[model samples]
Target: MLEDHRMSDISVAVLCREAGVSRTYYYHHFQSYADIIYQENIMSVVQYMRQLPDQGIITTTTMFTRYFELAAQSRDTQLTLVKVGLESSLIHSFESAFEYLVKNDLVVKAHPSRIGKKYWTEFLAGAVVNMAVRWLQTGMGETPAQMGRFVSNFVGLTE
Candidate 1:
């Protein structure tokens, strides 16, 4: 229904009626219909990230390919989330994903216990997200693979 009448005069009331649900129930299932948009967006991101071999190299190339595919599929949703100012948990979600890669030893950190002999993980981690945010803004001239390699190289995280 949202797909059919998203830009039309059809409204929340009409959606509720058409779906055979109360306004409360409709709203309850989602924080307004738009919430479904973002939730789907996040789930897609999570699923794409999940596909990389957990026990193998989750290289910059791999990261780039997956993320790039995700961005292409849901650019609007990603743009909205990135621009909306990330929630702490949202940022943490990225952190956790990287951590998983680290644990699987797929990321090949300079030092698993202490990369480059320092807790440079924070710096390394931030760089990925920072670059991603930049991509969100300008997307500049970089392909997702290129951007991924750039980020991976920056942190010395080799495949």
Candidate 2:
């Protein structure tokens, strides 16, 4: 529905109808439409990352690459979020997803510096989210693999 209509045009009632769920269920689970989109996007990345084999920097690069790939595939949704002034939601999603990886020990060897794991994860999450926002805003001309390698190199994840 978002593809065909602007967010402002879609009401919660409409969404509930489209989703075939009761308003009670929707309200019980989600705060708003934006929350629904945010959770869906973040969960998609988390699920994808969870399925990947842990392979050090290789896994990091692949994960970052997949992030870009997903963004590109969801250009419409990305644009809509930006248009609705919800770009921060996208940023938060990336940051939260990265934190989840770090916290769950899914991503290894993240602390190359003397920095604590918490700080290192925070730094990387900020860097990744900023880079991702810029890439999406600027038409994402670079390929996902290229962006992935660039991030890995920039963050010293690669030797």
TM-score of each: 0.59, 0.75
Regions more than 4 Å wrong, model 1: 1-42, 53-55, 87-90, 113-122
Spell out the clash pairs found in candidate 1.
none
Candidate 1 local distance difference test against the native: 0.60
Candidate 2, poorest ten consecutive residues by summed lDDT:
108-117
Task: Quantify all predictions' global Cα lDDT against the true fold.
Answer: 0.60, 0.75
RMSD of each: 5.8, 3.1
Evaluated with lDDT, which candidate comes out highest? 2
Tens-digit lDDT string for candidate 2 (32-126)? 78789888878867765764666643367877888778778777777777667677777777777776765666665444452245566567766
